[model samples]
Target: MDPLGALQEPLFTVLETPVSWTEVLGFGSGALCVWLVARQHLANWAVGIANNLLFILLFTDAGLYADAGLQIVFIALACFGWWSWTHGGGPADRLPVRRTARHEWAWLLAAGAAGCAGLTLLLDRATDSTVPQWDALTTVLSLMATYGQCRKLVESWWIWIAADLVYIPLYAYKELYLTSLLYVGFLALCAAGLRSWRRDLVARIAVTA
Candidate 1:
């Protein structure tokens, strides 16, 4: 009876697939990270770093190569975001939340489309990823969302909500049940985050005016 072996054993069955400890840990941490993000807490970045590391292993083992690679980028971005939240505001105490402008939305949409096309081609040709189109869509939009979050832009949540919608079904099809469930949670949090940031933006505008 090995102790580590017990941890690796299936905690339960989901649609005949074994749910293991690894996914459980990843799911928990991911949930916490999203909650923190929704609340506009600076600690989200640190928790996100942990979540990214866990998901890197989880995604790699699950054969989601692009997702695994995305975790690496997430790790780096988490570090940058941590620093940005702490110090990027300069003379201000913290970065202020702002709404995304119309022009910015146009550019972001264009970039997301281009990224999806390029990543879909790369993944389809270069890797054995089964859900290449959806994977690429989520991955590229996630990048945009992350950049928006680091800048404290309110529209990041909107982008995250879109990505999570696609990710939920994609992960489920891959039989990564816990990760799929986590994305469902993410969708709700993204909605909450949108409202939270909108209120914050309103307050900021009121103060400035």
Candidate 2:
């Protein structure tokens, strides 16, 4: 097996060294879903849709509204992404990694900012959650990151990597240290994605050159 895969093998536990069976199962499902996503299999999104449901409940119980809500959106986008990658981009077209277009980047930033404001106001008013604003900011950015991933944008990994780095501490603060480690794994996966996708992009350029 590849070194990256080997490294991930040891991290398949849940909730500290003690390892809860429930967390292990959830983490395993989530990991399998991500592996499929990395392989560009359309079925990944289906697995992800299921994983999102599980995570929605997990995050909701943890008081992570932004994450819970984002999971719902992920379900919608995962379906859209699965369809688009298969049919929208041309019946036989391959999903290729590409740099983010200027307009697309602008849209992501604007959407993130708008999402922060909107979520902050709504969460603040709707509940007594302490970190509603932070929750919204992270959620919006994470939404953009996931959307970027669905499109196979090279920069999506960067956005996700950044977001996950921030999320590590945030999850820890919420006493979900196990989930924090999961974000760490996500950060590593994002870096791996950057490398793998860059290789793909360079190969394409080399062939065209």
In angstroms, the error of model 2 at 13 is 12
Tens-digit per-residue lDDT, 120-167, candidate 2? 999999976778877887888789988998788989888887788778
lDDT of prediction 1: 0.86
Residue-level lDDT tens digits of model 1 in 120-202: 99999998888888878889989999989988889899889988988998889889898899999999989988999899889
lDDT (Cα, 0-100) at 160 in candidate 2: 81
Scored by TM-score, the top model is 1
**Which 10 residues in a row give candidate 2 its minimum summed lDDT?**
4-13
Q: List the residue pairs that clash in candidate 2.
A: none
TM-score of each: 0.91, 0.84
- lDDT of all the models against the reference? 0.86, 0.75
